[model samples]
Target: MEGTAKSLIEQTSESILNYIITNNLTTGDKLPNEYKLAEEVNVGRSTLREAVRALVSRNILEVRQGSGTYVSENTGIVDDPLGFSFVKDTLKLTEDLFEIRYLLEPRVAALAATNATDEQIEELDKIRLEIEERIGAFSDEHIEKDIEFHKLVSEMSGNVAMSNLVSIINQSISRYYDYYTSNRIKDETIVSHREIMDAIKSRDPILAEDVMRIHIVTNRRSLSQNKKNNLKKE
Candidate 1:
């Protein structure tokens, strides 16, 4: 009887989790009322509460007094590992990181275009302006601001998983950053950042996606050119 009850509660918890995912619930979104949720998951009220408690423990849900359960803001990503830090070959590591960024960031940008509020877009522009200023003055803080711009773009995407994942990369792995900052590259980077910001601000997802792709491709090309020039001098 004890084992059967445990299994039932586990199954109920999983069903609740699937419901949240299938519905695309984001942070702060309210879950169904307890009675409705219990009925939907084919569990009794007591078992449903137990399952909810389990999810709350995992930082996946939170209960508010006199309100309702909501998707937790934390989403459990804070302590996730920095994947590229263990990589030994900096060159290969950067190449891999670029590939991941290429695959993920354009979509992130597009989502940001669709989801970003006017206030968030304005904040993003502020970050972009700060980056341009620091870069022009050759202040190393520009590096931090550069990553800040990307992190803001990620946050605007409205996808908690992608936002947190990108934040992890920006905060931990800057292997490819600052490797190729020639005069031409800096000028082009400023232009590319502006293009990306403009696209998102206009709420044009397709444009956002295209410009972001171009931005990454331009950086890849600059890295390649620098490598070739270095090899020639060697």
Candidate 2:
């Protein structure tokens, strides 16, 4: 009987989670009343309360005096790992990190052009060609090269803060890339990188910044699309 109750509670929680996601519900969104949730999930109010209590403990929901239960402000992509059970929510957090990086990296490129040493430019060029070599043949190996190229550029900026920022952003982006870029569509990404590399190699700061901006913007759009595609498949 205990096991049966636990199973029902688990299923009920999952139903709530699925509903939140499908409806694009976000943080601070008010949850339906206990009676409503019970009706929607076809469970008793006692079971609904039990499940809601569990989620409340997990910081997924909050109950106010007369305001009713609301999805906590920390509920969605910003949800803490310990407080959230969904992997998709975790990916949303990752996407936010990437968005921040997208905003910062082009500035890093512009600074690198102003600050980089001759040897640094040479190093950047080397990685640029290496990345070009693996255009149509991208793999995990190429991903590493791709990161190396950016890391070298970040270091060339001679700004410790920018370098560290780039490092974190690169790491976050790497996770998304691993899932989104397979052999099926590697060329598109490789071509984009090549365009940026061309501007970098020419030492045109304005052009380099523009190219990098385009690349990051395109990448963010692509990643968002990939997430949607994965959801559809699921």
Candidate 3:
């Protein structure tokens, strides 16, 4: 009897998750009332409540005082599922991240060149212009814009799976950027970004891929050198 009850709870939880996914519910989307949800999932109120409690514990759901439960804004991969935080070698982790970016982003840029809509291409151009205008301002906003530009390119690739993977990698890179202390924005980087935008505008997949590769590789080298210098000073 206990095993059967547990199974029902698990199934109820899964059904709720599926309902959210099927309905295209995003972060902050309100869920149906408990009674309605229980009815829809063909589960008892107790079972449905237990399932929702579990999801809330997992950071997948949140219950507001009077507003009811809602999906979490950062639902997927809430914790370090792989124990990346336990890894002592920060340098290697950073390197691995860049290596992953090197493998994925050039291909993403190529696809974006071929598949991106006119509006998306125009958006990319706008981001590039923003970076150019902020080159000497020494504001971190440009760095953020750079990150957004890459993410936008990934989305423009029209591959949802690839875009999700790039977002994960880009998040890791952004975390690293918080620790990397550099105020100087290179002229080469600005020029390279412009070239990449031009290639995408021309719908030249090959050129776009090549330019992206050079851009990522250049940044990777800079980070590696910075790591080495920091280690020497320490």
The local distance difference test score of each candidate is 0.83, 0.71, 0.82
- How do the predictions measure up, each by TM-score? 0.64, 0.56, 0.79
In order, what is each prediction's RMSD in angstroms? 7.2, 15.6, 3.7
Q: Measured by TM-score, how close is model 2 to the native structure? A: 0.56
**How would you encode candidate 1's per-residue C-alpha lDDT over 20-116 as one tens digit per residue?**
9999999999999999999989989999999999788778889999999999986744343565555677666666677778899999999999999
Error of 3 at 203 (Å): 0.6
Cα error of candidate 3 at position 170, Å: 1.7
Of 1 and 2, the candidate ahead on lDDT is: 1
For every model in order, what is the number of clashing pairs?
0, 0, 0
Q: Would you list the clashing residue pairs of candidate 1?
A: none
lDDT of 3 by residue, 123-229 (tens): 98899888877766766677678777888899999987776577667676666555334544367668888988999889999999999999888878888888898
- lDDT, candidate 2, 1-234, per-residue tens: 367689889889888887777878778898787788789888999888888887787677788988898888646322233332345665786677677768877877777777788888777777767766766454357777777777777887778766645654665556544544654346555666676666666667787788778777776777778889999999
Any runs in candidate 3 off by more than 4 Å, and if so which? Answer: 1-9, 22-29, 44-50, 53-65, 71-83, 130-136, 177-180, 184-189
* Residue clash pairs of candidate 3: none
Q: Candidate 1, residue 160: CA error in Å?
A: 0.7
- Candidate with the greatest lDDT versus the true structure: 1
